[model samples]
Target: REMLVAEIEKRLPAWEKKTHLKCNGWQTKIMQNKWGSCNPAGKLWFNLHLAHTPIRCLDYVILHELLHLKVRHHNKDYIALLDKYMPFWQEVRKELNDFVLMPMK
Candidate 1:
């Protein structure tokens, strides 16, 4: 849990610096389906299972949710943001999708 939080914290500054978007706050929890989610208030939530995945997966999910603060939907603007920030996001997303979410201890 702490590892996931630390990972988010570590990547946030650079993302904020590049995009000028601030993440109000975030929480890690045992989500059954989604890897991450962003609220309208700019707060983010990451699936606790992410910590067991690759760092790239966590990074991808972080950027995915962060971009939601700007685009709100998986529209052109959101796709553009993902392309702009992480050019290889689709590949990383594919990798993430391959992992079956296991119940965390």
Candidate 2:
């Protein structure tokens, strides 16, 4: 998860150089009912299933959370920010969140 976050962060600047958000850290674990979560304090958590998702989907998630630094809630401003950075974010989000993967037994 840390590595994935790092990779995403590394690509963030190039995505929208105007946005000044930064990522403090991220964690990925076997969360039963969440795709990801971000807090006002800047912590990020992702479901373990994301490890297998396409890179674009991962980028959408990272950008979504990073936007929280500027907009705390999922309001118009937040959605607009995401739309600006990731035009297809909503679609990618639906695809990524709805994805279900079985863990190794």
Candidate 3:
């Protein structure tokens, strides 16, 4: 939990500075369905499980959410934006997606 918060604090601003996109706010919560989510309004919610993933995955999520501030959905424009920024986003996304956020019983 603390690690996740620290990573977000460290990464968010750096990415925001690079992308020139600011989010309204953000928080981490226990979520099973998604790694991260964002609204067109610029609020972001990240899954706490991210702490267990690789640091690069966390960076990917941060940039992914920030991009939402520009493009609302995962459409062509959004893909173009992500591709422009993180050329290896797809690999990181796949890694994060393959991670089990929770152990099923």
| Pairs that clash in candidate 2 | none
Cα lDDT of model 3 by residue, 15-96, tens digit: 9999999999999988878889997677999999888899999999999999989888899999998999999999999998
lDDT of each: 0.89, 0.73, 0.91
Worst 10 residues of 2 by lDDT: 9-18
Measured with C-alpha atoms, the lDDT of residue 63 in candidate 1 is 85
List model 2 lDDT by residue over 58-94, tens digit each: 7777677678778888999998888787788878988
For model 1, what is the alpha-carbon lDDT of residue 42? 89
Q: Per-candidate TM vs. native?
A: 0.94, 0.76, 0.94
Better of 1 and 2 by lDDT: 1
> Tens-digit lDDT track for model 1 on 26-66?
88899999999999998999999998889999888888888
Q: Please give the RMSD of candidate 3 to the true structure.
A: 1.9
Q: List runs of model 3 lying over 4 Å from the truth.
A: 103-105
Against the true structure, candidate 2 reaches a TM-score of 0.76
What's model 1's lDDT at 48?
92
